[model samples]
Target: MATFNKFFSSVFLAVLYASSYGNAAPWPTNAKHGTHRVRTLGKGVQVEAFHPPSSYKTYGAGVDLASSFTSSGIEDKTVSYISSELQVDSAKVTFKSGYTQNGQSFAYAKQVHNGIPVSNAVANVAFKDNKVIAFGHSFVDTSKIAPSTPSVDVNAVIPKTEEVLEGKKNEIEPTLEYHALADGSVALAHVFQVQNDEAGTWYKAFVDAHTGDLISVTDYVADASYKVLPVNKELITDGLELVTDPQNTASSPSGWHSDGKSNTTDTSGNNVVAYKGSVSSTTKQSADNLVFDYTYDTTKAPDVANNVNAARTNAFYLVNSYHDTLYQYGFTEASFNFQNDNFGKGGAGNDRIRISVQDASGTDNADFATPPDGQSGQCRMFIWTATNPKRDGVLENDIPLHEVTHGLTNRMTGGGTGECLQSLEAGGMGEGWSDIVADWFSHSDSADVTDFIMGQYVTNDPAGIRSHPYSTSASTNPLRYSDIAKLDEVHNIGEVRTVHPEMVLFKSLTFFFLPNPL
Candidate 1:
């Protein structure tokens, strides 16, 4: 089943950013002081807005509290402005971070009351030319709220937290923290980080210290590893062809197409390694190595295990190669590329892309899962067994590339939070993006690149799995925006909008802006 987690905040921010792009109007030269507008933002909070002169087309609003302000002075001014305008105490708000971007300074703050942090209570302030230009806040009044005191000891809550963890031991000792509940109340809780090594599960549990009841639990190790020895080998894609060894790229077939290294110790390393599925479905068992020889006769089908091994090698090479190719377009570690080992200097340091082949029960599909940021992303390719001769999903390049692109779109958008592409339209856009990227990677001038057929070899179908090939020709597939309301499936809608107009516009801009070699 296809599912996408909803991320409303990220989606709203994306729209706001897109709306403001390339629409900057000239700033007013004669801006005056004491000319500001105030608006109520519900929950007893207000925002004092100061816009540039009427002539400026750029949209920005904030409090005009100061003529000149620095990073150090932003918090004081923010608190002072909010306190005066909203009639709230400055001590109730806490500043989180202040930084400069694109010649504008931005700061984020959170609300706290009675020693308990307010959930979903936030404020953002922006400044330009040393003057406040934009400010927005979601606040809660704490004047009448009472502080919560724990009745139960931390030791008493440990057993309750451990019970919810199913006997998983706490990696870190339980700590006391205040949590804001949904009903606008605060509670003292004991937070525990629990893990089960054999099962490869990690969880964070918050247990109420007053009642010893479990408040919430989040699985950090969201259900989501190899070996190698080889030089050159014959692999099959369209047909049997000698390719570079995946283990060591610098061998006799020196310039082998799929040459890359593998490392089992470092989970976040650049090595493209493949591992066998675990024996138990619930627990994460150690992976066994898939030994590769120099050559294989593709004319005759090999054993199922051997076939999967070859597919794994091909997938590793293709993913790594695409990773390198995309690097030129800013898909680096700083930009949240899905590789454990990042060569770039920016982004979360330990995040990496992990691939698993032929996982559990030999299912007929592949899926990509991206957990919260700073955690490794996972892609699983299953075995296709419906046909007379069973097929390995990894054997085909398009399938693996399609799954990998999910990680790309998830990471690159929404600041690597994996939340930007979760809406209905975004979901359809995601499927289309994957298909386009897969075609781009596997395309050749002589091949039918524009046909938009997927998994033809794996599924053994001439027309492939999709209902129709995505094309611009009206006679072949004339899909328009009006058809969206009638379609209920994401993939179906994606096929109809085969070539997204936004994607076309983006490519055009990229080609125009980037330096031409010629």
Candidate 2:
């Protein structure tokens, strides 16, 4: 059976001794258009952002509000690092703390009805070694203001504030850190002092310092509801069967390619035929009203003559693309789960995948199909004659590419690190990358990338579209993530969308970070 591994647990924040980051890593040598800089800050913190110098203001107006809200509730001198698009002019972006109170609003409320100008908090952008770092106070210093002043020119404070912040670059020890995840995202840890009574509780929060998107936060005290369920082979087999039953006329009209094979009648005299080279008798287990099994064969061509090789080739292509193009390398093998229309039917509590294997001799040889099987023998790409062949046509290679790429990407980054969406984005980016790979596989040269809608290879039978629904097709399904309006759309609607996840990921990669991935 395939294995499911867990990485980081869902918890708010992690506390540890603050360590300075080592010298900044070299920038992408291949990409000439991007610049990389590095710097060290303080005893425990390190800050790294990518982009041209002076291109600080990309965060939306919401940045001002979020910063204000984040600062208003806390008393610590908040130091914020903002990210921005690379190459774009930096002077346009302005980081603000909060609105200024009107002149003497408290002492001369009637005299100064219109509030005073609020000082805009600014950050110092700098480059050290070769990576970029943005460091400075996210708020203005109230001490600089004289009490007798009728009203303070919020504008007047901007210059000195920038100078003080800029000077801190030389005073504080540099944190040698780069964002653990990527550029365009901010890394935050609550300021905690051991000897000082003023230090508040230490916590971690990251924002797309550029887009102002709350990428992730680690509090250690926040409630978490996610669980990492083990990979159940039986559930997978059952789920596959639910979506593709050739004999069952009521099954959806999805399609796939298969060698002629059959699942012989079961003990109940019901035909539970297993595909010839696809599954072995021993791996087949009766569970949850469905026959679950593991199937592997070494001889199947990526595209069988009768069944298109697009999906198979696409899967391989995805694996390769992730490694070669995306700089991700992981996972050793990939498997495709083909099943009938009733795949995910059992009570939600009992779903699992059944795994089975068979040899290439067209025999029910489990031993021959195992590791010792036929000098790296052909594994089951089961040609279940009973499967709805129609659905086979719907099998876009991107689905297999996406699934398999999950394995590879997982290995490269240790599966998941901080957030589930990070893991999910690893998967989403894998899917998008796979989709791109599948399109590229068809081209004669590097220029050949297909524009077909994603998930074109999987069945879209709204009722049973789990295995291969592209982000687009899944958009219409009730169980899928479709709405683009909600922030936490997946959790809010109990569904996840294919497009937006990829979009957020793409936006983070393309616009948020600097030193483009050339």
Candidate 3:
């Protein structure tokens, strides 16, 4: 961080001089064009976006709005140290929370301007060896921040915003915050999340507090409904049901069916593309008006192949569902999430997931291929021949989700590079995380899936494929860390990790953190 600090101090001083010379030097930053590209917004506030290939460590550095980390470095500092480095009063920066990932520690501080917080501002500094490794911040130059004292009635902003947005439900009540402008100024803004589930509309609205006028709306619904076996209802037992626009608005504003168009008839979309695999031609399952209502056949062997479209539809549905669900937990475009169009958010684009249903590559098992960022992820679902009438792996919701979770753990662990989980133990932990993700997504909040069995539908096994079902009770699942003594392979190694309730729920907390994963 010394290098980044010196770099920052120089820019800070330059901006200090710029303001002294009667110019508005608001967005002071430490970014170079080649290393870290600077983009000027319409408001003239410059933003420094770091491009990877370098780490934010001693020589390698990177930082962003959500999180910060160094590529190669030691340990990390305090709030006072952070305050001094950021050139801000310690009293003004209020830390919301802190957590650690990999070997480095991280803290999230909300910038406060004139007593009120900056709704979209953050001060990011990650340090090691008492030297700042790499840091990023949107902490307002308090001197340039617009005052927070509201001119309009604070209470009146809520109803006006809801009316302007035509929101049926106010998920987050209107709150005051100092909003930064592109022109090196700020606005007293009212921020809130509004929902209209019936109309499939949801977004976070930023309103000008002074005039009670809607300023901006960030879509929180990238959701799309699908008719397929849901998480809890696997094939052979549960029937298909309609999942009304399940994609999240924030993660996918255009929703799942859209790949630049309003709706797609086939099983290809911005988030995932599902089709038959291993054969000469990849046959896609098309729907009428986006209603992918394919019929399933329970007959034996070759006859089961007749209903391959159903499997394709199901695979597409499950993969997209997993993609959107994980996005809410921080697997975003910048974090190397699979998506056709990132809408220029960050990371690589055109790497949407590919799902091969009834794959000819293998049988009785499924797998996922996770390459580096910018490369598309591939998930192949095989046919299970154990039963007299073989089952299509794609028909089972958990099967596709389980495989897709492999991509999730792989891309997220190593900075979206997809090469981090290579060691024996790391590989084993990867498998464990996959199981936990699938297990976590397989049930609802009210359901008791502690003794969860994985791939039961595809494998046609009552006991499930894992060594033991995940359970809280020792008598039921019994496997523990002590069992690691007998396990060398990754799958069994992962089995020992997933049963812990604390670790399982720990994934849920990631929703609060901005994951760099890179």
For every candidate, C-alpha RMSD to the true structure in Å? 12.5, 24.4, 19.8
Model 2 weakest lDDT span, ten residues long? 9-18
lDDT of 1 by residue, 12-49 (tens): 23222211211122212332211122322212233332
| 264-313: candidate 3 lDDT, tens digit per residue | 66777888888774322333434445666656777646335447766676
Off by over 4 Å in 3: 1-225, 260-263, 278-287, 300-306, 504-518
Query: Where in model 2 is the C-alpha error above 4 Å?
Result: 1-128, 133-387, 390-395, 407-450, 460-483, 487-518
Ranking by lDDT: 3, 1, 2
On a 0 to 100 scale, what is the lDDT of residue 121 in model 3? 54
TM-scores for every predicted model: 0.55, 0.25, 0.55
Q: After superposition, how far is residue 420 of candidate 1 from its true place, in Å?
A: 3.8
lDDT of residue 452 for candidate 1: 59
Model 1 — TM-score against the truth? 0.55
Which has the higher TM-score value, candidate number 1 or candidate number 2? Answer: 1
Scanning candidate 1 in windows of ten residues, the lowest lDDT window is 509-518
